[model samples]
Target: MTASAEYLIALAGNPNCGKTTLFNAITGARQHVGNYPGITVEKKEGVHLFNGLKLRLVDLPGTYSLTAYSMEELVARDFLALERPQLVINIVDASNLERNLYLTIQILELGIPVVLALNMVDAAASRGIEIDAEELSRRLQIPVIPTVARSGTGKLELLEKTAEVAAENRSWKPLHISYGADIDPVLDQMETDIAGSDFLLDFYPARWIALKYLEADEQVINKGAEVNPELSSRLEALADHVAEHLQKTLETYPEAIIADHRYGFISAVLKAGVVHNSQRSDRLYLSDQLDQVLTNRFFGPLIMLVILYAVYKATFDYSALPVEWLNAGFTTLSAWMQTIIPPGLLQSLIVSGIIDGVGGVLSFIPLILFMFFAIAFLEDTGYLARVAYMLDRVFRTFGLHGSSVMAYIVSGGIAGGCAVPGVMATRTLRSPRERLATLLTAPFMNCGAKLPVFAMLIAAFFPARHAQMMFLLTIFSWIAALSMARIIRWTILRGPSTPFLLELPPYRMPTLKGLLIHTWERTWQYIRKAGTIILALSILFWALMTFPLLPDARKSQFEADRQQILSQLPEDTRTSLMQPGIAQDGLTREIAKASQRIRAIDRAESEATLQHSYAGRIGMALETLTQWSGFEWRTNVALLAGFAAKELIISTLGTAYSLGGADLDAGMSLSRRLASDPQWNRLRAFSLIVFIMLYAPCLATVTCIAKESGAVKWALFSLAFNTTAAYLISAAIYQGGLWMGIGG
Candidate 1:
């Protein structure tokens, strides 16, 4: 189809209303659709080809209302007003039609064509609630298609109706709802004045603009003032007058009255033979019944802990073999490259830098996949929402919103999420102080990038206690994040905690298709990073550690030492040792001793060469302070690379160890090398894990924080603050452990 034949249709809905699910069903896209809110913080677009037409579908953020109270609401409202899509597919939760239709009424006010996708009809039926789509369509004057977005039911019909609506090219006709005797006259005057002046009429309908002014929406008010200051001021004055009148007579403001009437309108629509509930009104639904035990104060926390531990245990148990297979595969690849590629800079770049470095991170792919699968399952089942609701009580104690729990969870509070999305998720929080606090602290969660580092350390040192160590680390992360949030609130971002109302979506069994899609999407992102960003950075770090060759004198001294060992051997033995693939069993004792000595000399020289390099010097400089935490020069180099990305800690360590003569066996993995190193004890491994978990976030996340928070200072503060906290905690643990003679 030609570009001109394409129709732009926007998908709109309240949070948890299956809007994105329907979008995915239509477009065959795998956009992250979560059971809870705040997953789609920005617009995602995909195309659908039907017959001779191309339908460009845009999935807007899920928002409860069109008012500018949160970033989501503003984004949805702005896109509809400015972009003016050909039609909007408004998905509503059929089970909770009244609450979902509040946003629908606001969308209708925009005077755009809308086809109501009555999503989750099966869920509604399961709950014994029935909705007559035809009657609802007739009353609202819009096509209402009964749908179960999860199963792709009625999606074709919904698209057909959408195309029909677009083909009509219908004129924009705003829906009008009565606001009662108290405020109707004021709205009439405001709407007429707005229409007469043509103020914001290019973007918004006249009556919608008036309603925004009445609602005291900051975005619309600011835009109005910018467009025409005099008209905006007059409207503001009129709005204030009516607001005062309403407050005096009804003891309520215009915004509240408007909301009440909107809900009232929705109620009236449902009451007009549109919805029938077969279940008794007094009976509790399945969700509420489950919430009774799942959300119980005592039992909820216990269940959450048990579930989290179980996920970790299952991940470790199931993924162990695959992880080993991947590790062995990478090891084989590195070994084969070492033999095939000549011993030179090119060989070093491929085998050590690219293979070993990126491979070390990639080796943990199985673990990451398993962990992400568990998290996605929990999220899809709606248990994560319940977890958030339970966490709200603790979050409030730390001067944070209940909404912040999801941000932390996304940041890897459960162990396999990213911090960039987590930081952006804070935009859902209304309180600026709480949002900033959330943005700053969310990075402390054990994000997927850091998972490899922790997994490696725990495997090497606490092998038998894989799940236990991970569980402890998860707890430690929460404690550290919450403690830091408390400190932030007590000082710079201090404020009273705002009340939070968390909506718990009904629990549904996660489909195999959905779980696999979510898992693969996240797992693929990790793999892509290893191949691209991690690959590039690994090569760069290798260069930094490789250049500036050893002086000629130093090289000769190592050569002379090797020659002396060889010179002592008999002539035939020397010739035999020099031959390729000389059998160790065939060698005499004298020749074997000489060969071992020469190999030791090579290893010593390799270590010295690394110590003389540029990266080694920088690592040496930090060693003075890092020594307290048992970190030597090599670990320091890896940690420094971690600032760019946490996953680099593993890759850089791989390169560093491989280049630093840890090539005892060509196939030895990084974790094994660390376990065999005399310097890395259990205490030191635990200390390093703690430090890595709490250190500065990756560079990408730092930049996101700066942009999201609208300040460079906060980003800088995160860097300085997180590193300092990490150092202090790690140092204390290492020093205290030695004093107590534990894990020595």
Candidate 2:
């Protein structure tokens, strides 16, 4: 359908109200993502085709209110007021209808026609809330469609109703609500003055503009003054007089009164038999009952630990077979390449460079998938909020605002989260210092990107107790992050401590579709990284490791040794070996042993040539400095590449070892290759794991830190501090372990 012919319908709602689930159900994968105009808040738009009609669906940011308090709210407001969608589906949490209705009321106030999609009606029902959608719709003068977005219940009807509303081409009309007699006079005056001057009225509804002035919304006030300073000044003076008059007489502000009246209206609506909340179990819902223990002060922390450890156990247990299968698959691929590519640089490149490098990435796909699945399950079940809730005390102890807990949790505090969103989540922290501290340390969590490296190491060296090791590593990360936050807070970013209050969402059973979709989204992201960035680095490292081929003299020397060993075999055995070699088995065995020695010599030469190559030279330089930390040139290369991304550590190690390290029986995974090598052992493997975990945050995360902090110095500090701390910790463990005879 033509763009102009398509109807524009916007979806807006409060956070966590299943608004996104509804959008996904309506649009499926036909969605395009971009940023809202002049804001970093994401904008999701898609097209839904029904009966050959195209509906351009825009998913606006999830916002609590249409106030100019945050970027998200501003984007939601501007898009509705300026872009002017024909109809908006205002999704609300059916369980918490009262609180969710607050946002709905504000949206309706913006003069936008809204269809209240009563999302999560099942959740509301489970909580013993029975909403009369028709009664509520009558009161609000809008259509209300009960829905369970996750299951697509009522989705078709919601869309059909939406199309009908859009087809009506209804003219915009503002919803006016009376604030008590205390404030009506001032609002009336402002509306009259605003209408008289036509101050920003063509863009904003005249009465809404008056209401914004009453609320003292900065954006609206600025816009008003920019349009007509004289009129805006008069409006501002009137608002100030009302605010002062209210504050002095009633001890409240205009915004507070407006909010109260909105809620008052909502309370009156619900009290009119529109909602029948079942009197079940002392009016306590299932979530509240469970939270009594899950968020308990004494047992909560202990339970959280057990739950996290179990998640790791599940991850390792389920992924073991798949990881091995991946290894065997890589090995088989390498063997197939050997048969086709012939024994030379091209063959080596295919076998060692591309296959092994990319294989190192593919090997961890199962583990990453499992990790993401577990995390998604936790988040979807609403336990992630409890995780943050239980950790609030720990955060306060570490001198961090409790709001930082969610940021850390989002950053993979339990494991498998991303730092970008985690960094953005810190915007909720009122204290700038606390937010900055969170921004700097959130990356310390074992994000999904780092899971492969940790899982690979755990499987290789601590196979017997991979789950235990993973649990310990997670604990180490938390200890390090909290401790670092404390240090930085007390030193550079010190400020007043603020209380962090969190809303604990009701626990719900995660649906299979939700888990699979989340798991695939994150898993696919890792796979794409492997195909693009990791593949490029693998080939690049392979070139750096392959070129500067052993000089002619050295290559000839190895060939001469092979020939000399062949010449030493008895003549009878040589002819007989070509005939019935069993009759001269002893001599034939001698030739085979000599040939094995020659191949060993060739491998040694390859190792030497790799050491002399460009990347090797850099690795050698780093190796010298990192020797105390038990890192050889090969590990140094992997660790260096890890600064860009943790997955690169695997690809770099694969390329490094494929070119130089002791040759494995062809096709063994990188983990197996490292395990069989002399340089790697349990102690050194543990050290390397710690080093990679604690080193500089990945480049993308570092960029986020810098941007969030609005200072490059913090990013620089994170790099220098993380590397220095990682170095010292790794050195201490390696040296202390060696002293205690722990090194193999």
Candidate 3:
């Protein structure tokens, strides 16, 4: 349906309120995940058909209040005031009636029509608490529906009520409440001034705008100041007067007074039989009971490790079969093209450039998809919050807030996440220094883009212990991130640290349907990038690796060698060797050996040609410096491509090996090629993995870092510092291992 024709409904609530579950149920496979404009906050929209009309639901970022203390609050505020949805579905947790209603009241103040979904009714009943939905709805003058959003109970009625409310022909004005004797007169005067000037009144209700101004909302105050400096000055003067009066009277700010009055309104409503509780106030729920042990000081960290290791094992081990299948499929397709097309630059470009280059990255699709599913499961079950809670003490020792842990986890501390979002997650940190340290170090986590490279290397060198190796790598990434953060905090970015604070949401079993939605959203993102950006960069890097063919003299030498090998064999035996499979005599074996030798020589010539090409020259130039890290010119090439995007490390290696080492006709996986290559072995592979994990982030993440930190120098510093750090550490490991007689 056309967007204009569809009814726009917004779903908003506090974090962990079953809002997402309700959205998943109502939308059901019709959702799209996107970022809000100019920010990293995710915008999730879904559509549902209702009574011959279409309902478009946009899931706003979860926030506790409408006060502009965070980017989420601002984004939600803008979407409501500007887009002006017909109705908002405020999904309140029935179990946490008062706490959830805090957000509901914020939404109500926005003046939008709201249908309250008192979700988790069963959980509330189990706690011996009940909410009178009708009475609450009457008191709030909005439709209220009690729903067990998880079980699909009361979902239809909620949507039906929402549609009824949304279709009504009436204008919404912001909710107004008295803020007591001290501030009421000031608020009334500000409202009069706002309405008289018609300042921001078209978008926001006059009193609401006045309220935000009184709360010192920077966005609102700035906009007002911009619209009318004189009027804004007068309003601020009045707000300052009230702030001084309130501080003298009750020792608080205007915002605090406003909040107190809001709660007072809610308390009065609840006192009028709107809620009933028959159980003990401190009764332990299942989540609380689980938390007692799960979030223990000692065992919590251990259990987190065990859970993370299991996720790694599940992703790598279960994904092996599909990974192999995808590798084989791409190989087969490349082979088919080789047979059909005449051999030359066109055939080589199609096979080596497009197929092998892109296919190598795509081959890990199963692992990426599976990893996303495991992460989604952890997040959906609310264990991720507990993880951060448990890690708070660990982070504080290093001068980070508990909030920093979420950024690390989101960036792939557990594996299969993105650094961009991780950097954005630093917004939760109130301390600039801690946030900057996190922004600088978050890329060290093993993001999904780097997962394929690590997975491929592990498969090639550590095949027998695939899962264990991955688990170790994950731990190593965390160690590097935390260590780098500690070093950075203590030195360059050192400043006062913030106290630790965290909210551990109650644990719930992840719904299978919700897991699928989240998994598909992330997997589709990988597939999309593979089709577009990765595909383009693959072709570009292919040309860079393929050109500057061996000189005519060099070609003549190889041609002469090929002729000598052919001349040594009988014509029939040589001809038989040319065909792939045939009976072999003593003579045929000699001929086959001669043919294989000639093929190897030609491959060497191609390798030499790549060494002389533009990309090769750059890699070769860096070889002397990187040699200490055990990176040869070819590995140097992969590392260079990695800076553009980590996925390119795998693709570039695939192309590099495909060009000169393995004949496309052989159809071996890249891991097999690397395993067979004499230049690569266990020590060098480990070194490369270490370097890739700790080196500079992809260009996109660097851009985000620069934007978020508001300094290009920080991005540049990260590039230089991380590269230097990764090189030294890798060199140490490689040199140390060599000295210990670990390599052949």
Candidate 4:
């Protein structure tokens, strides 16, 4: 069907009213998801074809009321009014008809065509309640269709009814809620003023905006003021005058009373057409029992921890073999390329730069896939909402809404995937303070891109037994985040916690297609970033370590010095130093004497080369400040480069060790290398690991923090606080270890 001629159906409902389920059932996998124009709120559109007709369905955000206290509500209201959809498919939960119908009544008053899709019919039936759809439709002067959306029952009928209503341009009769007489006159005048505007008349019925303005909805007031200043001022004055007449404050207007009127009307209709049996169903009792345990105060935190550990284990442990295979394949490919290509800059660029950089990212694919699958399973089983409900009380203590917990959990998997969505999730939060606090701290959670760095570090330092250490460190990062969140909430973000009101939906098996899509999307993001930013940085790091030809100069000087010393040692000794094989000469004896002197100079030259390089200079500068924490210049340089991205720590160490060509099996891991160095003992290694764990987040994380928080101040604070903490902890580890005789 052509776009203009296609039927448009908009899904509108209150929060937790089964609207999302209905949308999912109707659209299935044939949907495009994005954000609303100029806002972060999700927008989902899908095309469904049934009975030779095409329908373009739009799913609006769940909103309690259209008064615009939050962006979600405002977006829902604005889209309905401005878009002027052909029909609004109002999905109201039958079990909670009173609260849900309030939104339905408001939509009816907008004078737009609406078809009531009485969703969750099964739930209502299980509650021993029955509603006569025909009788209810007759009373409301609109069509009402019963639906169990999850089971796809009545979906076809709902669509047919929607098409019929939209095609005929059916008008829904206005239902009036009786606000007290004291406010009626002001509403009437405000309505008249609103009617004068062509823009208001084209979308929303004049009466709706009038009621909203009388209620002092900032969104309506701002829009009205922008459109017509005079009208807005008059409306404000009318609201004030009405408040004076009623002897009440303007902002504390009778919203609850008006709400009660709508509920009263709903009750009257229900009494006429709805019936309820005496007994409650088994399903309801079972669901309630499960909710109690899952959301219980004492067991909730423990449950959350267990679930998180399971996710980590499944993602890291189960996928270890596949990740290893990928790493081995890349190594084999790099080795093969070395033989086929001439040994030059191009070979180095392709093998060490491109292969290493891209392979490093791809190696984490197993973990990324598993993480997404685990999240999908939790979401599908409805455990995610339960998790939110359970954590509400605890999260509130830190000025974070329970809903913020979801963002943190998702971000913890991959920090850079989409901070927009992570921040957007905070809309479920009721308090502005909690939302802002969550937005600030969300980026600190390690994302998928950081996984490789962790893997590399753990593998290098604790190779034989690293998985458990990696898991423990992962848990430690979260603990640190929670502690920091508490500090911020109490010291900087002092405020009352928002009320936790969440709905726990029934569990269902997740769709494999959806799971795969989500997993691939996140995995692709990690791969792309590594290929671009990480790859470029790796090449630049290689250059910094290799350039200016100091090693070559040292080798040339050593050869010349050895030749001169050997020449004086006699013909046999000179022949031995010049020959390729040690066995061919008394040559071997002469060469051994010369090797000792050359070794000392080579060590000195290696130190000088490092001190003269760009990275070395920066390291030395940082060393002056960080020496107390047992950080040498090389460690300082590694830490500095690590800020670009934590995964670079591995590459930095590899470069420092000059082992890019060394076999993984043969080369000493970073930990072992450090352990062997007399200057760096066990205490230093432990201190360094602790410092890495608590250091300032990588550059990508900092960017996400700034974007999500909507300011540079919070991002800078995260960096400053984390870096300071790392330094202090590292210093303590060093000094404490010495004091305790763990290290000298």
Point to the candidate with the largest lDDT: 1
lDDT: which is higher, 1 or 2?
1
Query: What's model 1's lDDT at 300?
Result: 95
In order, what is each prediction's RMSD in angstroms? 2.9, 4.0, 2.0, 5.8
Residue-pair clashes per candidate:
0, 1, 0, 4
Which 10-residue window of candidate 4 scores lowest in summed lDDT? 659-668
In Å, residue 577's CA in model 4 sits off its true spot by 16
Q: Write candidate 1's Cα lDDT for 1-744 as tens digits.
A: 344688888899987788766776677752443322333354567788876778888888889988877777777887888889988999999998999999899999889989999999999998789999999999999999999888889988988888888877787899999999888999999999999999999999999999999989899999999999999999999999999999889899999999999999888888857898898888888888999999999999999999999999999999989999999999999988877887778988998899999999999999999999999899888899999999999999999999999999999999999999999899889899999999999999999999999999888989999999999999999999999999999999988989898888998877677677668878988998899999999999999888777788999999898778888877767766654334568667877777777767777877787888899999999999999998999999999999999999999999988988634546888889889888789999999999999999999999989989999999999999999999999999999999999774
Best of the candidates, TM-score: 3
- TM for candidate 1 is 0.94
Off by over 4 Å in 1: 1-4, 29-42, 571-586, 662-665
Residue range 342-443, candidate 2, lDDT tens digits = 678898778888888888889888888998999888888889888877788889887788889888887878778877778878887878888888888888
User: What TM-score does structure 4 among the candidates reach?
Assistant: 0.78
Per-model TM values vs. the true structure: 0.94, 0.89, 0.97, 0.78
- lDDT (CA) per prediction: 0.89, 0.83, 0.86, 0.69
lDDT of 1: 0.89
- By summed lDDT, the worst window of 10 consecutive residues in model 3 runs over 579-588
Residue range 1-744, candidate 4, lDDT tens digits: 344567778999976566777887777778776778867567889988766567899999888777676677889888878887888999988877777887888887777688999987887776676878888888887899999876778998998898777778665445566676666676776777677655356656777777776677787778778888887888788876765655564344545546666677777777854646557455455557777777678887687777777676666777778877787787677667766877566765666556654565666677667776777667656787787777667677666777787877666622223334565566566666677677656655665545565665555455555546655665665666677778778888778776666667655455565556556545665666667777788778766755554567665876687666756676655554443223423435545766445444545555666566777778888987798788888778778878887667655654554322222212233434454556866577667776876778777667666765678997798788889877987898888888899753
